[model samples]
Target: MVEPLRPPPRSARDDVLTYIKTLHGHQHHDQLVAVRSLFTWAKQNGLIFRNPAGRIKVGQYEYAMLQPLVPVQVDRSVAVATTPATRLILTLVAVHAARVAQIVTFMLNDTDLGNRRRTIAGRVRPPDDLTTQRLLDWLEHRHRRWPNTANLHPLINNQTANTSSRAGSHWISAAMRGQDATLERLRVDRQLEEARVKGPDPLHLAEDFGLDEKTAMRYADSARAQLPQAAEQPSQ
Candidate 1:
């Protein structure tokens, strides 16, 4: 007689890992999601005492393939950006490591041009004088174009009166034409640069760039790997 399938025991965690190893890429990630969902539901229903899939770890290499852009690419992307608003947004992401969503949602009140600082996603970041000047210029252009509109965001869609994240992404993509780069890549490049300069302190990453400790560690590790042997050499 054929054996009937039963609820997975804690030992089934091994089987889950084995199954994950057999899959690759997105399929591998998707399988993990499916397993977690199934086990979570089974536990809630009392079909299993614990989630077997909870202990399984997916490898990090798949996600870490997102490479940061070099300095030349960053400059080229900035040069090609079509509009002042788009250029301003690109500069912020490249320089401050600000998220695109945060840029899209930035309001007029968020900026302190006099102080050369801006509140990005609830965090105050001190942008350089050039970035601050670019923003001021963009604001002037925006005011000239939409003198009657009350929208606070400088990068607003004229039709919608507010910019969505998708629209903001499109604006960056349009600016990166011929240059193979994205807002996300620029953000990562900025983070790597920060890590290289600052020696990858998780606290600094968390406080300055608003990244979680774990993510900060990853960036730190990547940065440390890229550091020159001379930099790591102890002081004579």
Candidate 2:
């Protein structure tokens, strides 16, 4: 049986760099990071030790760069969000591809209906989860203060708020929802990729990809149709 690699204690920090390098290049690089974190935690607990990872050269391995998501993927993820505000936030993150702080500030300033105004005075900062909720509560209170307003939007948090249970849940909810959708899609894609690598049948592959049996069969059929003649031929 294969043993799982766990991070070493802080007292072992001085020797961690060597231990990290013991595993394969990828494992060494990833595990070393985890080890360094543990070492930092250990240091706080009075396990004083020299940080071996800091001292060691990290020039051996090239870092992996993630590819940007396509517009369709971004749209699909945003569509999964429960509310328009959340969806819009998700789209901005996945489309405009702005940072979370920028997204939060933009939406907050844009949607500020209160007498008080918040502007990008200096460095742009996104509000924390609590702040977002506070803003929602504030808007709801203001709407209640002036009931039966000419503009119906004074009462709605997002366009789809009334229909969504997650309405007024978070200020950065659109971004949050988009993130959840993105993760779910990635997980589905990853499972599908793994099933392909394992060469599973359509039914199994469908189950893995969260597809119905008919859809799985159709997908498999399409794949079979696309395979090269030589690859599809029986062994000589």
Q: lDDT winner among the candidates? A: 1
Residue-level lDDT for 48 in candidate 2: 61
For residues 36-68, write the lDDT of model 1, one tens digit per residue: 989999999999998888877655645553355
Cα lDDT tens digits for candidate 2, 103-136: 4334333444343332232323233444345446
lDDT, each prediction: 0.76, 0.47
The regions of model 2 sitting more than 4 angstroms off are 1-18, 24-27, 33-55, 58-61, 70-72, 107-171, 174-236
Which sections of candidate 1 miss by over 4 Å?
1-19, 24-30, 36-67, 161-174, 177-179, 229-236
Judged by whole-model lDDT over C-alpha atoms, candidate 1 comes out at 0.76
